[model samples]
Target chain A: MNALLTSAVAGLTAAGAYALLGVCAVFTFRLVAVVNFTGAAIGTAGTFSMIGFISLGVPLWPAVVLGILVGTLAGALIGLVMTQWFSEATATTKAAVTAALLVGIVALGLRLTGGQSPKEFPTLFPGSAFRLAGVEVTVASVLTVVLALVFTLLADAFLNRTRTGLHLRALSERPMAAELLGVRVRILALLVWAVTGAFTTFALMIIAPQRSPDFMSLSLLVVPALAAALVGAFRSFPLALAGGLTIGIVEGMSSAIDGISQYRGILPFFVILAVLLWSQRGARWDEAR
Target chain B: MTRTLDVSGLVINRAGLPVVRGVSLSAQKGQISVLLGANGAGKTTLLEGLSGIIPTSGGDIALNGRSVIAARAGERARAGLSHVEQGRTVFRQLSTEENLLVGMAPGADLADAYDLFPELLNRRGVRAGLLSGGEQQMLVIARSLLTRPEVILIDEMSAGLAPVVVQRLMAAVRRLADAGLAILLVEQFAALALRIADHAYVMRRGELVYDGLPQPLLADPDRLHHLYLGDVQAA
Candidate 1:
């Protein structure tokens, strides 16, 4: 029972990370109607940059900040391409762009690492065990979980409470109508890209220490995060965060048993596929909230 | 110089076919100039062309002597030619208040908008899609008023509306005109359009066929019959 409880808490921490990435994915997808297949790779690139900067004798704080800023700008460029060049592209073409970008990010990651094996990443938090009611937890994991909650809450409030937030959602729903209503649709789309870039950069930078910087592992991050977004119907942040936590815990618990870790990552992909199939059979996804 | 919209020898094409051919018209300041026509008469097309939504095939549109053949829709809007589009096109996703704010020229008399349509203040937060047809029409008109343009172009304000709603809208148009703003309205409801218009023009197959005072157009049953009532009388 203690082991189960430990796994759940660990899962929650991991869930937080997934939630952050998922929100960024949702933002980018809604802005330009393209699901970014390269989001994780962009994040991994940020992680590698942080490591490189730190190794170059830069302070950890500045390195992390610079890494995040650079990653975010890169993400915003993805939005720019979608708005200006890909605006007229069909769904197939949009998907192709995402696939190409994903491949490019992977190639970029290999170049950054000099084609070396997976290496441990630096962390802002000291690597030490702390006990919370006999539950052992790392400081980095605690910070990740707390930051995730804050980020999700802020995101939800922004989407629902702010004027531009409402405008963004409305533009995504019916861009033509919004344009006729005197909205600058192009600007709004670009802003979404810029903000999501920052989000993915920060999310990757925060959790870099847990895994080595690699293309395959970073790209797979979408599986779990996308599961959370699917749970929210890509409209409700609360649902997305809850879905993230649940998937994290499930993955964590699977690791408690022998030989399960190898297949544990498949859980989110299965959940996402099931949700997609159900939604497809139920109602149209593009009708907007 | 006084505000005037002069579209001279204006030709408009929809899908490579001329819809409005050499249509020249003018609405002087403070006058309610009306366009009378049946469906497919190119009245709406003329408005769309003058508003810069559709590119003019040939001819010229000048507002106070400034040509606008190549201006964008928003740019035209900012230049003081406000179009309350046909079918009362309201942004379904925006709140009524947001719609009003968007319609206002970069800076104009917003207080006049509120005073003109006090009902808007109450429904400011409501998305326009859910409003009743009458309310939606009112909202669209109200937003246009916020721009306080020298010339207001309203197309088919009375279309598909109840008599009472049409009466209220006509009253608002009169109010705007009384305040010295020129109004060019394209309306199919001949009797209603004639009642508010100082002058009226009739269009047939993308050309202005008649131009005169509203009384002559309204009193001539034979001409009116020939213009709009042939089917009703025959049927």
Candidate 2:
């Protein structure tokens, strides 16, 4: 019973990180009508940033802040390119930009460590555990879940309660009308990028320390996060959160199923693809907006 | 009543093809100027050019003595030129109130839009996509009013609307003009255009073929039939 509870709690923590990443993906997808495949690359970039700062003898506090700051800057730069250079750019062009960014960032990661094996990441939270209902839950896991909830709530509030958020939604839904209404369409697009970038960076800084911060390992988070976003049909915050948690739990549960762990990598793809195909029977990207 | 818009030798090209050729027109304060044309007559294109949404290949658009052809859409709007484009281009997903709010700048009085079309205020929280055609037109026109533009360019204000709705829209146009807003109305309906226009210009194949006062143009049935209406016998 203790083992089962601990597994579930750990699964819940992983879900929180997935939710954070998923929300950012949804934000970008809704605003620009493009799925960001390179989102994980941005996370990897943040991890490198954190480690780079730490290597320079900077304290952990400043290093973390510096990492998040770099992430924010990355988001702003990506947003600028998408909005200004690609205002009238085609769908294919936007996708190309994200793909290029991902490749460039990953290449930068290999170059930064000079082919040395990637090291264990520094922790943001104390690696301590507490027992709840006979379940041992780590401090990092609790913090991840709490932070994810906080960010998602704040984002939801920002979208539903603020005038600027309304304008941004208008810009996303019908760009031409928003423009006529004097809403700055280009700026809104850039803003979406900035917000997504910041979130991706923060999420990476929080999670990268638990695993290898190599390009492939970090980039794989895109699949689950994207699955979370997809399951939400690109809307509904609660659903996205639930979806993220579900993926994380499923990922955890699969580990206990005898030889199923060997095929764990293949399960998410089949499950997500099937679920998406079933749910999105007649949905089109343009019609949603 | 003190607004004026003057377009001189306005040349517009789309994809290297000339759409409006050296077309010069004007709308004086408290006056309604109508541009009458057949399908693809470059009527909408000219309005877009004046509003700064479309790039003009040549010529000048001056709103109250300030050149606006090269200005950005928002800048031109700030300079007191508003456009109600051919399509009732309201933000469809936004609630009626939200759509109106978007057009109402931070500094402007939103109540004026509601004053012009009180029905929009009634359906304030409703999504704009669900509004009736006439209601959508009213909302769009009312929203554009937020800019308090000296010149209001309306394209096909009557298209796809019921006759009574068209009458209401035309009446609204008249009221705006009476309040000193220079209005450039582009329409396909000759009778409707002539009803409120102080002056009218006829376009055929992207060139201005006739420019004159409304009464004389309306009275000459034979000339009108040959130039605009398909046939007198058919009418």
Candidate 3:
């Protein structure tokens, strides 16, 4: 139906945001061995802080920059803890630490923002760019798609072509070996976290206005992002981008059906579950990478 | 002889248990000092401690007559101590050429690494993980060489390889020593290692059970077997 097409087109913005988050997840996990469960929560905190800055009558653009810096700082702090204490820890241990941090940040985020209350989430880009299938296409939607593609292209090039990228790839695959080879593991890890932090927050900020934005709701964007990451096996950036867009389109199509609209949030969880089971179909429970 | 790398009373602990128990050894410039031991004799631990990959509980590590005890793993590497760790820890996703470039010195040439392991040059675009075991070992050794270290610590270079590949790698190690770099080699093959070694050491239960010239030990198999009694399979 025409309604389904409109909804699918509308989902493009969320798809772009999901792609960005997925790319970030891939980047961090590849370079630093961190399965960051706090990706969305960190962005939520930063976006709320930007809203706080705007409420104080400060200009919107400066507040956005300051908020992104906060997110970067949050990521840097997490990186510091992991690098200092869990530098040699197994991947599971690192993931557990981030999961604990996510829970803590969620508690803090909810307490600060107040529960279930929707605030005015201002849009950086407003107004529709064009029309398609009797539906208006927003400039923000087009911008987000472009941003996702640009990030994917840039990340692929950096990981393959640059000296730091080679060092990062080396560090990710073999941490102890990288250190013995004279790569500054701690510094590079912090840089990866900071960059991803800035990206995730910006991704969420653009899409906030179109959604029913609450702290908990915003923090749970991690589900789809996680699904997107799973699609790439936390290794390939282009695969992650494609996965993100697909999940967003599916969610949009699901929203077109009244019965599934309320349960749309759980759609990503199912996707994540399906991906996990499918990827490990023939592999045994004891199989390890 | 000028010692390029020196460790005295080195102690490394894992899970609060001392793995390298107050071990002392030295590697002189332009010479190969072979350290032979059983699987659990802590040869790898000692090398890791010496290279600063793991913290030494108590010890003094001096490189080029200067104490490097305060340095971290990366600092030790930059200070000319290269560790080609066991398990052939090449970055799995990176290409063969990228592996060499990752830890190379500022002015180090990729061509030199390629020349050392000519087998790797043909597989420049291949991911390290996809390389055969022999080629991976070659890549790791070549990578360490690209760091331009004064002293290199190579642990178990022949872990899992064909005997011919092992022979080729041992020859490469000898060539590296001949090129004026101090080499501390921990190996499984006693006879092959001893053939190219100037000095020899045998560790048992975290202690140096034998320390002297390689000629005497190479001439006596019974004594070498006795030193490696715990792990009878080591040759």
- Top candidate on lDDT is 3
Task: Compose the digit string of candidate 3's lDDT tens values, residues B63-165.
Answer: 9989999999999999999999999888888889888888889889999898888999899999899999999999999999999999999999898899999
Highest-TM-score candidate: 3
Ranking according to DockQ, highest score first: 3, 2, 1
Candidate 1 structure quality by residue, lDDT tens digits, A242-272: 7877887788888776788779879998889
Better of 1 and 3 by TM-score: 3
In candidate 1, which residue ranges exceed 4 Å CA deviation? A28-60, A85-120, A126-130, A159-163, A166-174, A277-289, B4-28, B35-72, B86-95, B98-111, B121-127, B147-151, B198-216, B219-235
lDDT of each: 0.75, 0.77, 0.89
- Give interface RMSD for all predictions: 3.5, 1.8, 0.7
Per-residue lDDT, model 1, residue B214, is 86
**Residue B39 alpha-carbon offset, candidate 1, angstroms:** 4.1
How far is B201's C-alpha from truth in model 2 (Å)? Answer: 2.5
Worst 10 residues of 2 chain A by lDDT: A1-10
**Tens digits of lDDT, candidate 2, A1-289:** 4554556676766677887777777777776666787777776677778888999999998988888778777777777777766756666888788888777766776777654376678778766568778766677777777766787788778877888888777777766556655667777787787777777777777777665667567867888888888777777666777777777767666666667756766655875797777877667544675
Candidate 3, residue B61: Cα displacement in angstroms equals: 0.8
Extract clashing residue pairs from model 1: A72-A197
Q: Global CA lDDT of candidate 2, please?
A: 0.77
